[model samples]
Structure formats: C-alpha cells, structure tokens
Target: MSISARRHTRMATVAIAGAAAVALALTGCAGPAEKPADGEPVEITFQSWVPNIDRAVDAFNAAHDDIHVTLETITAGPDGGYATMLSAVQAGNPADVVQLGYDAIPDFLINDALEDITPYVSDAKDLFVPWQWQTGVFGDKVYAIPQASGPLGQFYRADIFEELGIDYPKTWDEFYEAAKVIRASDPDRYIAAFAFNQAPWMIGLAQQGGANWFVPENDSWKVSIDGPETAQVAEFWQKLIDEDLVKIEADFSSEWNADIQNGDVVTWISGSWADAILRGTAPETSGKWAVGAMPQWKAGENVSATWAGGSANAVLKGSKHPEQAAEFAVWLNSHTDSVSILTEIGAGWPSIVDTAAIASLQDAPEVFEFYGGQDIWDVFAESDKAVDTSWSWPPLSSTLFASLTDNVKAAVDAGTPLVDAYAKTQADMVAALTERGISVD
Candidate 1:
C-alpha cells in the first residue's frame, strides 16, 4: 500500500521551483471541477496522435453514459504536439487528457503540467504492467495511465542473411561479425544503418548495454551521458562506421526508404512497432522480413530497452473534470474493446497485464504473414520482460535530443570519432540544465 523507497527518492527531485509555480497556478486559477447536473454526461477532450484511436474514443462514449470524450487528433509529440500542449498549459487551458511518451513524463512532472490522478486510478494498478505503471508515478502520486510499450527488437531481411550464410545475430560480437560478412559479400548491402539522427534509437542501444545516462540523486540529477556502458555502445557503433560495415543514414528518409526496399539495408534494430512501418514502406518485400530479439551485450544476457514509441495518457493540470478524465483513460486502455482496436491499428504493444487474453494479439494472421509467418509478437513479449526497470528518463528531454543530434552530426561532418559526441553532450546537458536552474550532480 506504500510507494517504494527508490521511487520516493526519485520523485523528491521533481518538486522544483517550476512545480511550485504550477501548484500556485492551479490553486489560484481554478477550483475543483463541479459534477454534472442530473442526466447530463461530463464532457472531456482527449488529444492523441495514434491513428484510429478515435474509434476507441467512440467506443468509450457509447459504453459510458456518464462521460463523453471528444478525440482531438494531433501530430506525434516529437513532430509538434509537445510544444502545442505546453503552450496550452502555459495559457491556463489544456485538454482533459493527452497522450505523452514515457520519457516525457519527467519533464511534465518537473513543470507540474500533469494532475495527480492517484485517488482516481490507483485501484486499477494491478491491471497493467508494473514498470509501465511506474512511468506515470512521481514520488507517490500517479500522473498518467500506461497505454502502450515499445520493447526493442530486430527486424531484418531474412533472405539476405540466408543468402550470405549468416545466422541471426544473438550477441553484439556476433552482430559485428555478421556486419563484416554482409559488407564483404555485397558492396552495396550492409547489416544495418548507423542512425545518428535518431536520438531515441541511440539511447535505446545504450540502455541495452546497461547504461543509465540519467539518475535521480539527492534532489538533483546525476548526468552521465558519457558513462562507461554508453562508451561501449558508442565504440561498437563507431567501429562499424569506421570499417564501412554499416551505412550512415537518417531513418525514414527517401534514401533510407529506398535502401530498405532494395535490400541494401538488411536490418532495422528498432522497436516491435517497426514491423508495421516496414510493412507500410515496402509492401512488395513481404515474406522477406523476420523478427528477432535485440542482440545481447554478452553471449547469454537478456537485457532489453524501450524505444520512444511507448506512450501514456495523462490528465493535464487545468482539467475541469480530472476524475472523469482519469476514469476514461483507465477504461480506454484496459478494456478489451479498446485494446483490440489499438492492436489492430499497430499501436505500440499494449501494456496490459494479460497480453494473451487479447485475441487480436494472439491471432494476427495478416501481421504474421507479412513477417515470413513468424509470430513477431512473441519476440516482443520476451523483450518486454527483459527490459531493465531501473532505467529512468531525465527532465529537459527535448534539449537532450537536440544537443545529441547536433553534436553527433557535427562529429560526423568533421570526421571526428562518433564517441566524442557523447562527451560533448555531457557538457551541453549540464549547461542547459544549470541555465534552467535545475541542479546537476
């Protein structure tokens, strides 16, 4: 019935001056939202980027006579929605509920943008995965409801690996050897692309290698983007770049799309959700692709990580109906109807405790057929279990991504070692956090 000591310590650091300002704003600007009149449903707005999620909202509205939710579709957070939401928060009006990536929870918490929904949703805590549920909790307060997850995995061109006599890599060392073989076999083909432009993918790799880039420490953050475990990941990828064993390319670009279609880029080390992207990008290459668990750091290790795709629904600070909003968030994610719709739409893997009970997940024939008849969901389920629960995202994530991307791009352009970018990022993060009046340990 009590919060863990680790979480107690972590959340203590989130109550900064920004949080104080938000608390004052909430108390001074608005009182508790009043209940609706007799026979009138409480109306609330929900903002999200997940395609076809509106259908789930419709289902909720039809099923619940007490609450009616309006779905306001927006661009994915990284593209623009985060700024839009923050602006609304600053202006003293925001949607009743909004979708946010797991990593963004800390930033929202530090800014006090989210409402404490603990009193409303704590009873349903056992319905979802524990680690994911924790993503929404700061100290002892729950600010969000877990909806989806992004367990890391490998999506590869199975035909190419077979043709080159290379088995699916099970370890990082074996992956390097496979990279060498793929390059030596065909000048144009490589094992995977070095996606320096994508910060989340790079961070996921470091996480898989036991890197905790950010740690909560005594009411401050211990910044360690250049730690030893991260160094191992950087050096491994840098070796691939130096040897020309992998293509240096930005993902989802015209060039990268062409490579994926033509089999030049043989593998994509991304989240389980990538299967849908690959299917949409290259429908002509069906049955050529397959899925595998992320290659381990050592021969038998089982560490995994979450990509940026996992998201949660949080009630904003200024909502007039936080109680109804929290109820809708919980029902929409846990109910079979909503979870099935989410699965059909290729929303990231659901965070429900009983994934097996979801029929859509158990028998997705079309999805299996696309990936060479392999049940890719099985791989993701295992990867989800292997993920380290200790990994935590820091505040100022937007700054973190921009700094890492710019520094890494500069390094690549200057022909400097890619590992140097992490060190540079270390300095950039500390400066930015200090300027914002956040303590760095």
Candidate 2:
C-alpha cells in the first residue's frame, strides 16, 4: 500500500482551521510511520464535532508516551465536516482519524476514503454493543470504532401532560389524539414538529417497523425510498400535518428554538442526544420534561427505532499511521476511563454496553435532572435493544435524504400531500443513484 505523503510533528495540535489550510497541513503520504528522533511522539490528527472530547485526548496523552492525538472541530456537522473531510482526502491531506456519522459511512466507502481497521479492531468487536459496533462494518471490512449511539424516543413536557389531564401517548393513534387535546387547550400550541426537512427523522420512524428502503445486490446498490413501511410512517405524519395537529418547522432555526422555549412545540420526537440539546436550550423547562418509550404502531406494543445518527473514529486511508490511528480510535472509544470522560461530556450513550460509562450516565442525578431526575437512560437503553436491526443505511444515504427532503418538503410547503411526496422521493432517489452508476431497484 502506498503511504500518505503528509506527516505531523510530535504533540501537534492545531486550532480548527479552514478547509484549505487544514488540508494543506495534513497533506502528505509517508511510508509506515517512523518513530520520531530524540524520542519524540507520533502525532495523530482527529476531526470531530463533539465538544470537550479533548479531555479524552488529554487522558490518552497522559497515559501513553509514544502517541498523541489532536482533535479538530468543525463548524457544522453532518454537512460541513463530511464535505471538508472529502475535500481533504481528495487533496491528499486527510487527517489520521476522522469522526464520521454512521449514516455517512457508506459515502466514505463509496469514495474509498476509509482505511480498513478490521485487522486491529475485529478482535475487540465483543467490547462494543453489538448493533452500535456493527455500524462500522460494511462488506465485512471494519472501517472505524463506534464512539456513541442514540436510540429514539418521544421527549415531551410532563408538566403540560399533567396539567392537561393526559398521559404520554403510547401509540401514534393516541399521540394524534393527545395532539388534539394539547392543541385544544391553546390553539397556538402544537404537540410536535413534523419536519419534512428532517430526512433522518422520517427514516427512523419508518425503521421502527422494519423499513427496507435500501438494498444491495452484488457490487451495486438499490434503493426503495417509498417502501411500504416507510409509506405507512409518512402517511401517519402527513395526516397530523394535514389536520394542523403538528407544527412544521425547520430544525435548529431560531423560530424552532422559540417554539421549544415557549412550549409551542410541546413534544419532540428525538433521540438520546437531543436530551443534552433540550437541557441546553430550555433550562427554564427543567424538571418539566421527560422521555418515554417511542410511540408504537399499536397501543401496548413494546417497540422502538434508531434514528441513523452517532459517530465513530475512522482511520482515514491517507493516514501514514493507520495502525497507530486504529489503536488510538479503539482505545479512545473503549478504554473505561476514556469512555467515562466521553459519557461525562454528554457524548450520547456509551457504544460499549453495560460499562461504567453507561452505569455512570444512568446513575447521574444531573444527567437526568432535566427529566425530574428520572432514569431516562433506562428508556433509551431498552429502546436501543428493541431497535429494528433489519435496517441498514444505503450507500447513497445522502442522496436519498436529499431527495426526500427536497421533494417532500416541497409537498409540505405547497400543502399538496406528504404520502404522495414519497413516490417522488423514491423516483428522485432512484434517478440520483442511477446517475452515480449505482443500480436502483
């Protein structure tokens, strides 16, 4: 294998740089890493979106003398970081390790941007929670180590539910009714936002019932974005929107934040990671919020789904220190102390199950303070177990999401019909994939 040409000095930690500048800094292909002269360390550059994760790097630096990691933060995740990383890789300046979303793994693979870490991490497979760990495996080649996992749930205002003489809806039918009840109390209030812009959210809901929107055949890929289960999920949400029972808002916008703060959006269909976001956004709503099991297809059904999110550390193909990067990625995610620090910083649920990391999260009063000190981890932990394991992200996930977001969002904005948009999404997805020379079913 040809080594990357870029190399960094010992203990090199650069502040987040512009894409071109960072690419220039990381550009090079050196043969297998050579120990620095005068007993200097080998430096590994990491690009990620998680804040305060530097504590883990510091911990690793303190424990290991030969290897040092430097973390780089991106301005916008899932969109900006993925693009910049691709630019860096194409420019031959890729970081030694990059934090990538589980959904984005196939894109990186499609570009051949990740190094196969199977030789290093295949043995440690048993250490991580099974499904979370499997996110990095494609074509039986391990590309990365799981750093976090987020199981889906319905986060809602408990105080409001109590004031209105209602309980958390256990089924979508009940949720629709609860939405009416909530809306009836104050005509301006809404139960939740059915964001057509949120493709992952739609995909997650469909995944709850074993949606098979994506499939693969031989070396090519196939997509069925309008699969039956997905259509059912979409039709349900569409009814809520059509009835004006749910709000429609672009996420992370100021208006959305205002709705959340003012309780205009009383319920949020989100994942475990949103817990931290909720607390950070609505500190005044402290003790008023709670997480419940996801709304199911039928009442009294014990079921849930995983929104395709979370990130992992991958040894980039351009790295000259694949072995060192692989080892560091594994240790950063698996070492008990390191994982605890990550969990402490609210890095979502631990990828490694039943570890002190999860135990600490479950036991932390502050972690659950937003939920009136309830053990919401138990909700997410169980949800994680019940997730639809039949689903796997398609290699063209970005295209599929873009197709759904654009076409479906148009329908939502135009007041046409959401279910009808699914057909367009499927057609657009198939067309997009076909342009990429990927087979579409």
Candidate 3:
C-alpha cells in the first residue's frame, strides 16, 4: 500500500446548507426556529487537540444558524494541553466546550472549570452506553458526555504471524509463549512491543479486572498500588522484559515506527486509536496488520476487559449558551448522522449505543483493508462491551504517570528494589495530592 493509497477514505464534505437540509428532511416538516435571542451571534469556543474538530465545527455551524462555534486547536504535546486550558480558564476566557480526557476530568472538576450536567444527562442518558456516560461523572453529577472511546487490544502484523506459522494469542500465557517462539526463531525480532517508559500499558493491565490504582473511600482517595492484582500484573510484565521476549522502547516516536515497519517489532498492545497512528505511519504495511482482544488475566478474568482512552465533550461553567452547547454535545455524541460524519473524517468510534453505527463501520471495506482485513469494528465493539467502568484517575494524572514511569524505570533499568521504587512513587503521589488538599489515604 502506497502512502497515498493508505490515506483515509475521501468523502465529500457536507456543506452547512446540506446539513440544514438534511436536518429539515429528518424533522419531516420544516427547519428549526430562528435564534431565540436576537442578541450578538453567540460565538461558542470549542477546544480540542484532535484534527477532527474542524469537521465537527463545520457540521455544527451548518446545522444551526443561531449559534456559531469557533474552534481552538490545542497541541497534544508533552504538557497534555492542560496548562493552556488552565491558564485560559483562570483568565476568565475558557472555551464553551472542551474535550477532556478521562484522566484530566478530576483535576478540571477540582478547579470548578467543569459544569455539572446531571440535569442535561437525564434528557439523553439513554442514548449512550452506561459506562461511556458514567466516565465523566465526579460524584452524582455528569460533567462530560463521551465523544469517543478506544478499548485496549493487541495490534499485530498478521503477515508476520502467518510467516511464522502462529495464531494470535487469546490469553496472557499464550501470548508469552508466542513471544518466546518469536524470540527463539529470530533473536533480533520481538513479538510484542511497548514503551516501558510510559504508564499506558500498566494502566491497561490494572484495568484488566476492573482494578484501579485509586478508589473512593468515604469521600477520600485510597491507593491500591500494592494490591495483589497489581503486583501480579507487574510481575508478569517484568518477567516478560527480563526474558527478552518483548521489545521495550523508550517512547512512542519515529524510531519506534522504524522498528515496527522493519519487523523488529511485530505487535503492539494499545488502545484502538493506535490503528490511526499505525495506518498513518506505515501505509505500506496496510493489509498486513490485524487487531485482537487484549490478552486476558489467566483464562476467564472478568470477561477480558481493559481501560478505554478517549475524550469526552463537556460544556464549561462559563458558557453563556449552556443549553445550546449541551444540546450540540448530545447531538455530536448520539445522532447517527453526526457519528457518520466523524467516522468519515477518521476521528474514531462514537460512544453512542446505536448499533447501526457499529454495523455501518463493520461493513466499510476501506477501513477493514486499512486494518489488514481485520474486522476492527467487531474487535472494538467487543472490547467496548467488556470495558471496565471502574477505571478512573485523579486530576494530576499526568504527574502520577510521570512518577510511576520514573519509578518503574529505576527498578527495571537501574536494578533498584521494586518495593522501594514503588514506595517512593506512592510518597510522591501522596505529597502531590496533599498539596491540592486531596486526601491520599
């Protein structure tokens, strides 16, 4: 597959007029009423890091004549773009709607930057999956609506697996055995790959059985880093690294891409959104890749679930047009037409409960081809169904990840005692949380 050939499916852009026309046609009689308030055209600002925001804003502007949205693109860099949002909100000019990741919600809520949409949720709560809808909740109030979700899975080079005469592994034991086989066959090549310097994989492992590092206890946060389940998961990964069965990279970068394309790394354990990165980076490897369920804990560990990594849309407290913004968010997340538009633009799978969107995605041959003929939608849907809704994070999730990653590297690379390293990480987390007046008991 050439680079040009591997590009996303080119679909005609739906004009604003076309969207209005379609909305009118769906309503059966006439278009929606004119602007309720004839005041200045309410310009709602939307903030996000994804490139698909442009398309969403365009569709939104075309569908409604009353409110115009101005999208502000934030770079998804090392800072995670939270600093930008924080500064803006502190300056009393925050965006009307912001795309908040699961881990970032708690911090935003703590700062009172998010609005409690519990009232609005009752209007369209039935339209989304329960877990998706609940991801943004801080207490009894909904703060965000799930816009997209990416359940963890194993992305592998199918062609390489076929060449080695091996099947995709279904369990962790089998996965490790397969890794050993790949290592023995070609000492320089690895069956699975990851950036050990990152905590994303660990988060996936912890969520394998609905386990989380933090849990709510009497309105205070409690740590579970040393739980039996977490220890077991850590030991499993540590053993794999020690045995040289998996390739450990420093980070996700161009060098990692080179390793993947050159067959030095044949598989990756990550969320479904990784498909976009894979397809974009290794276009020549397009029909050779496939996706499968994340290797489970033992055999039937709580139905093989993992944590999801995606963003949710929320209306900020400062928005003047809260009602309209809330309505737009519901439409973006639940309406089939909006979801189709998002899919066509290569955003991601919608969080809506509408099975028709899943069906339509499954039937798209271009998407399947990009995934090495794998029924990726089926894999995602299955993972979505089995997702562990208990997974959550604190507002300082980025800091926590940095601390844990540093500790893990110290133990794995510097030969430090794992227990001591984890203790240091726990202390660091406690201090950070304490500084914010959050209890880490």
For residues 76-153, write the lDDT of model 1, one tens digit per residue. 755588878877877777888999998887777776678889999989899998878888877677889999889899
Q: In TM-score terms, which candidate is top? A: 1
lDDT of 2 by residue, 197-309 (tens): 78878878888866767654433445666778777887888888878898888877888898999888998888777877888888898999889999888767787776675
lDDT of 2 at 42: 87
Q: With candidate 1 superimposed using the best TM-score fit, by how many Å does residue 71's alpha carbon deviate from the native?
A: 1.5
**RMSD of candidate 2 to true structure, Å:** 7.6
> Residues 1-441, candidate 3, lDDT per residue (tens digit)?
222111100100111122233332111111232354666566677877876668767877888877788888987523756777766666655677788776666656555566666786667877877666666754346678888876777888888888888888888888888888888877679886646676766667767844667765544567776666767777777778778887777646777889788777888877666766777778888788888888776676534444335678887755666666777778777777677666655455678878685444747676688776667877877877777565556546777878888887778778555545556777888787666555556
Query: Candidate 3: TM-score?
Result: 0.85
Mark the regions of model 3 whose C-alpha exceeds 4 Å error after superposition.
Answer: 1-40, 119-121, 300-302, 305-309, 344-348, 358-360, 417-421
**Cα-based lDDT at residue 301, candidate 3:** 55
lDDT of 3 at 181: 81
Model 3, residue 82: distance off in Å is 1.1
Residue 358 lDDT, candidate 3, scale 0-100: 45
Q: Relative to the unseen true structure, what is the C-alpha lDDT of residue 371 in candidate 2, on a scale of 0 to 100?
A: 88
